[model samples]
Target: MSAATSPPVSPSAVTSAGRLAWLDALRGIGALAVVAEHMLPWFVPSLRPYWFSLGVYGILVFFLVSGYIIPASLERHGDVRAFWISRFFRLYPLYLVVIAVVLALSWWVPVREAVVRDGSAVAAHATMLLDVVGIGGVADTMWTLSYEMVFYLVVTALYLTRGHERSGTWAIVFAVAAVLVGLVASGAVFGGGWPAYVSCAVFVLGLTGVLVGRLRTFSACALGVMAVACLLLSSRVPWLGTAVLAVMFAGTAIYRWERGTGPLWPVAVTGALVVIAPVWAIESGWWWVQADVWLTTILLAAATFAGGMALRGRRLPRILVWFGLISYSLYLVHHPLLRYFVRVSGDLRGEPLAYQLVMTAAALVVIIAVSAVTYRFVEKPMQDLGRRISRRCRGGPQGGGEVRVPGESTGDDRVLRHEERQVPHRVSDDVDQGESVG
Candidate 1:
């Protein structure tokens, strides 16, 4: 590695909070791909084959990125309280705003409101795991958040139990278990009335156990297993959901190995499982049967991740990096914006494809503009506040931070107490924090 790209080898090294710029570019690409995946179908009906939805490709990329980063974030903070607090601030603010916007818009456009079944809407909205607990999302795109939450919780559990180093092994185990469980019982493990409530209750208890139980290690391990079970059984799309998570953990394993924290074999094993498990599920009559598209998407996701890692040292364009900075905002805002646009404009039928393309282009412009505003006004400020609170809660000096993994920095730490007083107009270190898209 070049000196500039090399990870820090000592405590005194000046680690940075800057992300690899190319990864940000990838985030931007993934966000826009999702936008196209949803928007294109409305415009181009011909593209709607069971072959591949760009949406799946985009989300899988996001899952991989999340797996890579979230664990690193937790380990860096080394304080579960701070990590949770930071995560809450990082995700919830924009999420709430988008939900509020969508809810407000639903007054005029009834379709904007998601299906509410048996008063489960509130719980689903509150937890963002609507699909997992046998409920629907307020927004269709929000279902992915449920899996992301489970990943975070399970990650936290592993961390607490000091078993995080075995993430790859666990990932493989989950994938294999998903395959085994799919054979006989491929539905919700817990059935009967209020299954959502029961799942939520178990999640809460498991979360509490890991966070504060006297036997936290055992609690964490048990909770991790239960969480995997929930993923494979209770989620609306069990096989796909389980695979998404396994892919994410594979990303995590890749990151760990990249950072010299683990060996390549575990990542290799996880990658093998990642490829084999989903295919097995499909072939065994447990999941979707679109092997051609699904397999291609999986390979594409793997290639994209590998490409990002290979290109980590190269400089990426400013606009792409900026798009990455605002990607979360884009991801959250696009669906609502599209819904409102479509509601107001009505169907664009009978118009030329070019005209629809123009409209889509206009929508993209609007989404980006709104996302820029939200990132600046909401995401960035909340992140700063979260950092301050986290630092306070950790009882550290106000301006200081530490890097985990003593020999290498993950580029998530900020340097404080610089002698130079002048701040640059554009902060080069305005790295996007979270990997979860929505």
Candidate 2:
């Protein structure tokens, strides 16, 4: 928090708490939102207004979480190669497996036209480009990933170069300028235009402060201000996506300054408002009320972040952590899955409504089964494997809370279990071998 602290390793900060569990709970919450959003039509008319559109907020939470975590992972390893190797193992394999399964399901399932059309726009989604020029667009609540991957790549690069402190500032300026230019060029910045580029830039631009050896007061204040401003104006901001992206960037800044003191009350207050500005727009009576919403959102994110810090050492259920671990994959695949089930259920026609209900249950089971499979068989194992490989190749601590580019500890996180073992078994002979393969 002050100096170059280590990465945050516990699912949360508290040693007594199940840090990972909290994250899993958040992810599970998000996943449910996605499922309910997709199942809108199946529910009775009175209940079908897409109650879970708020899941998009959950996706934004994921991005904020990523902004907090990815840099920590990279900082732990102290090398770009190892950082990338870890990322490859962490995301790609599971993503490929999930996407492949979704693609396969199209044949047997009766997906909706819009669902499939939207899904198709994101052929590059697994690559994390939901904002791209539409091989497939961000149809399945997956648009957040483009920023996640971009953040991973850029933050790792910056941290490794030890220029995170300096470059972060410049990146933000440039990225914002890009958004403004796109606006000037087209006379509109939203609607998939230049602002989207800026929205995409949030992830990349955030890397600047990620490598910070210490969190700063001013930066925190500035981030809090900008995020609130973005929210207050969300209605005018085209798709509201830019504000989502800004929060991701702002979240990183807030974390950079929070410095593990647990969240400061003031920062936490502002954070909350920023996270929920969109709600203010929908619920408030006047445009000025929306401005108040901005402050409220800023208050929310800062407070929750602080809350996350305070809750760090508290104990939570293991089941919760397990769910948190596979959240990203679940988030990515849930929409298509729900759509596929709807398609298949429609064909059954026993009772159109009845089939929808039965298949909805089936869809839940399938998502859980698939996420469990991915976590056990793919995500965790590969993460362990990749960390081992990275440690062996780089010859440094491999399983700490944060990857230290300087190969030292700032104490942000504990060493993961396997990381604590001297020379994990897989790393000894496999580092070079894995490097080559990677």
Candidate 3:
């Protein structure tokens, strides 16, 4: 999954699609990693390795991608209203579809026990803060959306304050907080259903103010504060939530560095801190969070992002970009479809290795096919609608025009012209901007 607007392209850029093909490539790889992480356990248990977590690696890549692009998206538009509109349409249409599918299949698959135990599925899911507020997602992958939402709220606030460029400083701050919180805090201070309700109310009120432009700054700040508080006080693991934010900001820091506006040291420092954050954390009992495995996963994810950045000027393989195009659908739809497959075919862990491998391949084919369809009919249309609505809100014609802000790069301006020619009325092409989870 990814959560960033597509980077601007220059008219002379060699990429075929007028979009960042490397980012799409990264998203595609991350999505496949997550899919394999989930599918292997049930389909080919022996192939599932425990040396490092595929799921964690995939999601970290997603967070980095989101961090790198989301700020750029908001800044390029220079309008919180348009930014949120693009974000909502990009994320929610498929998200709601997944939720509805899960509920409709509940009689066959049954909702996760954690969701029932938390007893605030509606409220938590509505806010996409389910994990931090102690609720389980209808789909296991949905836990990641909580952190994504938090990042979005905080990023929006920072954009409103014109402090969004300080990505490196924010990354370091969150990294330090993660270590300190790990040392002192053990579990959620605000547990149970009430926090969900309160947080949901705050989310609603804050988002309403942001969209409506009434006391917008205060509302954005309040939402930011609330988001941070929830991450520290109400998450399943405070240190992890804090560290995830650090990772995301570190990504933004890298983006700034690339654009010649930020230092690179904070990215290094934040990465170091995040790597060690869970080493001594009381809440971190999972094997993957142990020093060795965690370090490997973090480094690999970082390297992957760096590799993508290095290749940004080149044309990536079209298959990878296509995968990235449907990556969001792949991320949201794969797990439930896998569950339904299990319900129909029964667990194949006991099957022969060849048979299991064949089945897994078949399942992957189905998932990719379904994801492509959903992206075509569901995600793309909603995104185009969002762009049109955003243009109307900005008092622009719902057709073709370039939006030039004072500080925007000349390269971006050229890219905007190219985009207008190729994809008229498009604000962004990267719609699958969220983390992939297992």
Off by over 4 Å in 1: 1-19, 47-51, 111-114, 191-193, 199-226, 276-289, 396-434
Q: What is the C-alpha lDDT of each candidate?
A: 0.65, 0.45, 0.79
Assess candidate 3 and give its TM-score to the true structure: 0.90
The residue-level lDDT of candidate 3 at 286 comes to: 81
Cα displacement (angstroms), candidate 1, residue 126, comes to 1.6
Q: Write the per-residue lDDT of candidate 2 for residues 191-283, one digit (tens) a residue.
A: 333333333344233322332323322332333333332222321332243444444545555445544423334234334434343443445
Candidate 2: deviation at residue 329, Å?
Answer: 3.3
lDDT of 1: 0.65
Name the weakest run of 10 consecutive residues (lDDT summed) in model 1.
419-428
TM-score, model 2 to reference: 0.62
What TM-score, over all chains together, does every model reach? 0.82, 0.62, 0.90
Per-residue lDDT value at 377 in model 3:
92
Best by lDDT: 3
Where model 3 places Cα greater than 4 Å from the true spot, the runs are 1-19, 117-119, 280-284, 396-406, 409-415, 419-428, 431-438
State the lDDT of candidate 3 residue by residue for 320-357, as single tens digits. 87887788899999999998888888889999999998
